[model samples]
Target: MKPIYKRIVLKLSGEALAGEKGLGIDTNTIMRIAKEVKTIQKMGVEIAIVVGGGNFWRGVSAKEMDRTTSDHMGMLGTVMNALALQDALEKLDVITRVQSAIDMKQIAEPYIRRRAIRHLEKKRIVIFAAGTGNPYFSTDTTAALRAAEIEAQVILVGKKGVDGIYDSDPKLNRLAKKFETLNYIDILNLGLKIMDSTATSLCMDNKIPLVVFGIDEPNNIIDVINGKKIGTHVKED
Candidate 1:
């Protein structure tokens, strides 16, 4: 089936691949993600990914240490996750490329917008890493920045906790209201957990669609790519 968006940026939470271990990458989890990505790749969707490194380290968790130093270390952690995901994707026979925001030429290409778009055009999945190559920025911002630069039709978010956008944290609040559709302003107004405010604002300004789905579901990525009704849709109304 043809995907709803021809070109899409996939935002994955690092914790999703932890598989209850919460330490490092889980091979079975990675394979599941890769297989899902492979299924979509075969549908001819140009894919780009921005993965968070929360499974390894969180920037806020490093605040007790030197702030800048800790943040840089966090960026490196993201690169680690990126490479891990890239390896998984390739093992699934999917052509993949890793681009780092920071200059890590020996391991991966520095993120050059045109080069990344070119990779997408060639049907190679591009994995973006290093969290904007700067401290004080979240991977959510990186996803927004890259999505805007590459002009992706939408950002398909694979969130670890809580499936869709909710009035409250579904994991904590059993009575929370889940939304099937929300406008960008609605997210801001209702405080939806789609993306960070910065990310939400950026996508809102650019009119980029954001879909939040549960990554715990095995075939959810493929379902999203095939335009299955699997998550909350955040768009400009």
Candidate 2:
């Protein structure tokens, strides 16, 4: 199937990479995701990924720790995830590059907008790490920022468990209704938990469309890009 968007930023939560274990990277899970990514890459779509570090660390969870320190540690965790994902993709013969906001020159290239775009133009997958090199910001915000900088057509968010954006937490309330499509203002006003307010606002201001969907099912990424409509699409109404 043909991909609807020429370029996209895939926002993956660290928990999604952790799979059922709920912590740390799951080999089988990452491999499965890598294979799926390969499929889409072969479809001639430029892919940039912003992976979270929640599997390794979450600043908010460390209530007693200094917020900045905890957040910095969280950023390092993202770099680790980026390397693992880069390895998995390379093993599949997909050329991938890891760009870190917090530079580790020996391991990854520093975040450079033009270089990233050039990599995408060359059909190389670029994985962004380190959460904007700032404390208190989330990987979701990083995705929005990078997408806006790279001028991507859409942000495809692969959520860990839930299928799409709901009126309330589906796990907590089974009766919660799912929204197939929503506007940016609706997300802001209703305060959906899909992405942080800062990230949501950035997407809105830039007019970037987003698709929030479940990552559990195989081929969900491919399905979303092929326009099967398996997720909640957010855009300007």
Best by TM-score: 2
| Clash pairs detected, candidate 2 | none
| lDDT per residue (tens digit) for residues 104-209 in model 1 | 7899998999999999999999999998988888888899889999999999989886688888888788898889989999988877656778888998899999
Candidate 1 segments exceeding 4 Å error = none
RMSD versus native structure for model 2 = 0.6
RMSD to native for every prediction?
Answer: 1.2, 0.6
TM-score of 2: 0.99
What lDDT would each prediction earn against the true structure? 0.88, 0.96
Which lDDT tens digits does candidate 2 get at residues 89-193? 999999999999997999999999999999999999999999999998999999999999999999999998899999999999999999999999999899888
Best candidate, lDDT: 2
- Model 1 shows how many backbone clashes? 0
